[model samples]
Structure formats: C-alpha cells, structure tokens
Target: MDAGPFFHGTKADLKVGDLLIPGFRSNYRPEVVMNHIYFTAVLDGAGLAAEIIPGDGPPRVYEVEPTGEWENDPNVTDKKFPGNPTRSYRSAAPLRIVAERDDWTRLTPEALAEWRTRLARMRDENAEIIN
Candidate 1:
C-alpha cells in the first residue's frame, strides 16, 4: 500500500494528542487513526509520528526520539475488519507520503448495489437531477 504523504521536522507545535481523534472509541490503534480520517477526515497520524526535516517530494528518514510510550494494547489489536487490517500501535511507522486521487469505483459491493437501486428508483420516478 502507498503511504499518502510524508512530513518531517520537529513539529513541536503539534501534539501527539493532536493526532488523536476526539471522543475516540476504538480499542485498535489503526482503527482509531482510520476513525480519525473517516469521521474527522484528517490523515496526520495514520503512521508513525516522527521528527525530521522534510525534503522536496519525500522526506529524509531521520532518527527520532520516542516522545511517549508505545503501548501494545490487545484491546486495540488482534482484531479483523473488512478492508483494512486491525489497528495496532505496532503498525505505526514514519514514511514518505504519496499523493493519488481517490477512485470512488472501489466501493463495497453492498454500497454499489444500494447506489444502483437508488438510481434505478430515481430514474423510474423521472426525478430531476439536482446538483
């Protein structure tokens, strides 16, 4: 899988807790991060939080001191989801970010079926297209 984007340098202004989604209810670390993106729509901490100076396109890997304890909570790990792996603190890593456009055609079968049904009903009703 492609790492989305890479940022480096000491973002002292940014807090680890800042990467955390507020009112996070997941026991999994990755899920927590995904929930942060799915609900809050942010991708700052999907991977490891590191301290390095960013280069032109990708970032230069640098040794970063651990800011806090990396906990391996089973309550958050050892689970399975449909598409993505279960989130774990161990899965955290710092990597270069890659940019790509979202392909909406990759949606789940159930979601596609629902959309098809909705569209068919709309077509039958001759609903005016609203944008």
Candidate 2:
C-alpha cells in the first residue's frame, strides 16, 4: 500500500522545501492531537482532503516524501475499507514537500455540499478517529 510517490493536500501555502510534521489536532476530531502526518498515493484523494481543511485559498496538493517510518493510516485501513485502497499512510516523522501539484480534479459544488453534510452528520454522531 505504500507504493507511493506520496502526496499531501492542504490549504497552507507551503514551498517545495517545506516540511509537514505531526503533533497537530486531528481534522476529523479536533479534540485529539495527531501524532502522525498523513499522505496518500492517490492525488485526487489528497485534493479532497485539502478541500475539507480550512485555508485562506483553494486547496493544494503537494508531492512529498516521508522522512521516517510510516504505516497504514489506521483511520481508514480496515476501519472504513477492507485494505489500503486509498494508499494512505501516516508517519510520526516529518514529510518534506517536493513540489506543488495542480492537476488533481476539483469537486463539483454538489459533491462539496454532500461532503459538508456528511461531515456535519459525522460530527453530530460523534464519529471516532483512530488517531
């Protein structure tokens, strides 16, 4: 599942040499501080994640490299899908940004709306985040 030229998506205006580290609040469960930085091999999947996170501008996808050991993102690995179909992983170490990618597809308005609704419902239901 780690067959990646990995990518991370976010709204942060980071440069090619920037590093993404862990120890931040979980985007899904804000009350939990994340110990791992997440990434995926699927570009558009990162784009979708970027869209979910708040930012000053449109979401951006970045080519990245994990600086240390990583593992299947427990949040999705068997908890949601049967395996790592998304090719998502997380690391306690830093991820170095290699370049910015602009080719990922953006979600349509309807799709975005549906996502927002789903997120709200998850919040209402007290959905759990593995990390």
Candidate 3:
C-alpha cells in the first residue's frame, strides 16, 4: 500500500475508530452506488471533496487507515490525469477513522460555488461513472 496517512472526506459527523465502508452512493453522483471507499494522501484534496458534498452539515476531513487492499481510482487517475498524481485510491474495504483533521485549508465561498456549479453540470449531462 501507499503507507498512508490516508484521509476520507465527508459531511457526516463521526467518531474516532469508526469504519468507512464501500457500497455507498457516490457523493458526486448520488444515483450511482460506489464500489469503493475513496481516500487520498493529499490533505487538501480530501478537504476539497468534503466541502463539495451536498449537505447542511459542515465539511469534515478525517485521518484514516484502510483495512484491506486498495487501487488507484480509475475515475481520476488515467482518465482525467496522466497518473495518480492526485494520490487518490479506492478500496472495497472499510477505512478506519483515525482522527479528525481541523487544519486543512478551506475553500473560498466563490470556489465552493464554482465547484457546485461544475458538479451540477455533470449531473445534468448525465455523466457516466466508471463503476
């Protein structure tokens, strides 16, 4: 594995030692069930994900550990970039929440709004999830 210091981003309130499992709907595409629980080695990347999640709760980024094997996220890996420069991975296993990270940089309101707009456009276009 990447010997991570991994992190998962979400708007869900959680406690230390909680497990994040796969099979949940994609926060980016709610109609598509995610086959893997995604995490990143980059702190800000996770923070970006958390911020864009649709919810009324505050976005949260958590330090995490994977319980099983993981692979590069095909969605953003070669598909969107040349490599796993995003440091993103997905596992068909549970990710144990280690602790909450409060020091991640937050996006500006304008940046957040822009992201929401881009996501909404993807949804309206009926973007395809790689599964």
Q: Highest lDDT, which number?
A: 3
Per-model TM against the reference: 0.22, 0.95, 0.96
Looking at model 1, the pairs that clash are: 4-98, 5-97, 6-97, 9-52, 27-76, 30-87, 48-93
> What local distance difference test score does each model get?
0.28, 0.90, 0.92
The list of candidate 3 runs beyond 4 A from truth reads: none
- Which ten residues in a row are the worst by lDDT in model 2? 50-59
Candidate 3 Cα deviation (angstroms), residue 32: 0.8
Error of 1 at 12 (Å): 44
lDDT of candidate 1? 0.28
lDDT of 3 by residue, 5-108 (tens): 99888999999999999888888789999889999999999999999989879999999998988999888999999988999999998999999999899999
Predicted structure 2, TM vs. truth: 0.95
Ranking by lDDT: 3, 2, 1
Please provide, for model 2 over 1-131, each residue's C-alpha lDDT reduced to its tens digit, 9 standing for 90 to 100: 46688999998889988999999887777778998999999999999999877547879999999898999999898889998888999999999999999999999989988887888888789998877
lDDT of 1 by residue, 17-39 (tens): 23422233322221232222111
User: After aligning candidate 1 to the native by TM-score, how far in Å is the CA of 15 from where it should be?
Assistant: 39
Model 1 regions lying over 4 Å from their true place: 1-100, 103-105
